[model samples]
Target: MAFWIFLPITLSAVSLIGCWTVYGLALRFNHICSLRNWEYSNSCLTNKTVTGGCCTEYNIPTISGSGTQFPENSLFSATINAASFLFVIFSIFHYAHILKKCTVHRFFSKSAMVFGCLAGVGAFVAGNCNPGELMFLHYLGSALSFVCICFYTVLLTFLTSTCILTGLERFLYPVRIVFSIVQVTLTILYCIFFTQKDFYYRHISAIFEWTLSMNLELFELSYAVEFYFFSSSMLSVLLSNRDEENTMILS
Candidate 1:
């Protein structure tokens, strides 16, 4: 049971480290343009940069942009798939934990699970559909993931504030609220800047995207505390067919 805490820990670690690794690899391969050179001309997009230079519009270094290359794309897809799978398990575990410990906030718990699972599915889709080729699907998946995660965190924060299921709720509630707010703020900024044609705004949006991802990873990391209290029995309860509507109704 104590080892369950590693689920969230690994999820956060894999997502954060793996994505940046892909970005670094993409840079090494010149698959994507640099993020630091603010003065880099848009001519880079027209093959005007030096020979063999990154001559693409992917100057943003977005997680999607960073993974548009060959080997890096493979790593990127694997990382997102792994992280998304863990997120689905995390959602299930959190819901089961709530059912095991609390009698109230069932609606919020169920809603959080829906959003969390949808977010995971979106991540999966985005991972498998590389943005360079499947731009529509990739952006669709990214949008779904972002939007669902925003709702998921807000609902989870609400549950944390109302229920003391986990002993860490007192601290976690405020912290989750802060994360939720920042996540929403960054999501909005990322969306706004993402639409601009100017490379500067696009680059800023990329920064927002990376920050949003790191913030989410940190949020997931906080749940390691809650997972520390998890038990295998909680999952058994969730899987049991016998339902007591009078007590806990998962449906």
Candidate 2:
């Protein structure tokens, strides 16, 4: 009973930590990349002086005085790449553990693991691109991840529907199906509309305007939602079974 209760919490913690680790790695990568073309000299532009100053075009500014030295895009990519790699490993291990237990929804669990692996790899590769080039990679990677999310959502819906129909429970069936449909529709719309070149430029414009960060928060949100849904479904099944056993014993 305790194991069932703890499993979701543990998985959630691991996933969140993994995400943070990826974010840190991205910051480091950005710092390293920014240092390559940075200048370190008195000629550094402080506030766009209009004076006819004696300045060299390729002047090396001091590390401390260089303007906007932080490579936000690179850092974001690095974090995603690192985090995705760790996520892949974690998902694989989790899948194996679940399989060993012979869970009722093994099919859904296995499918989620496989799709999670693909999403992780895609994210890592997409994270390797620079700012201007990141759009293409990000779009492609995000599309793949969203597709996996849709699959997982559908699988969970099916599992939940089956469990309910089998007289396992009654209340969760309609709710699961409705959530699953909504997720599937939203994922499809995201893939179709958001992955376009025009949409990428629109986001770039927002980034330039400082309204949005280099990292696509939407991707993170999608992952979080899917994770929650799947994790909840798994927990529901475990809890329902436990309750059944208790009822049997009581009778």
Give TM per candidate.
Answer: 0.92, 0.44
The candidate maximizing TM-score is 1
- Candidates' C-alpha lDDT: 0.86, 0.45
Please report, as a residue range, the 10-residue window in candidate 1 with the lowest summed lDDT. 47-56
TM-score of 2: 0.44
lDDT of 2 by residue, 143-220 (tens): 576566566556645654543222432555565566566656655554454334452332332222121111222223
- Per-residue error at 147 for model 2, in Å? 1.3
- What value does the lDDT take at residue 222 in candidate 2? 27
Each prediction's RMSD over C-alphas, in Å, is 2.9, 12.5
Candidate 1: TM-score?
Answer: 0.92
Runs of candidate 1 with Cα error greater than 4 angstroms are 48-56, 241-251
lDDT of 1 by residue, 1-251 (tens): 78999999999999999999999998887776666645546554564322243344555578898888788999999999999999999998999998888879788998999999999999999999988789899999999999999999999889888777667788888899999999999999999999998877887888899999999999999998889989988887676523565346555
Model 1: lDDT to the true structure:
0.86
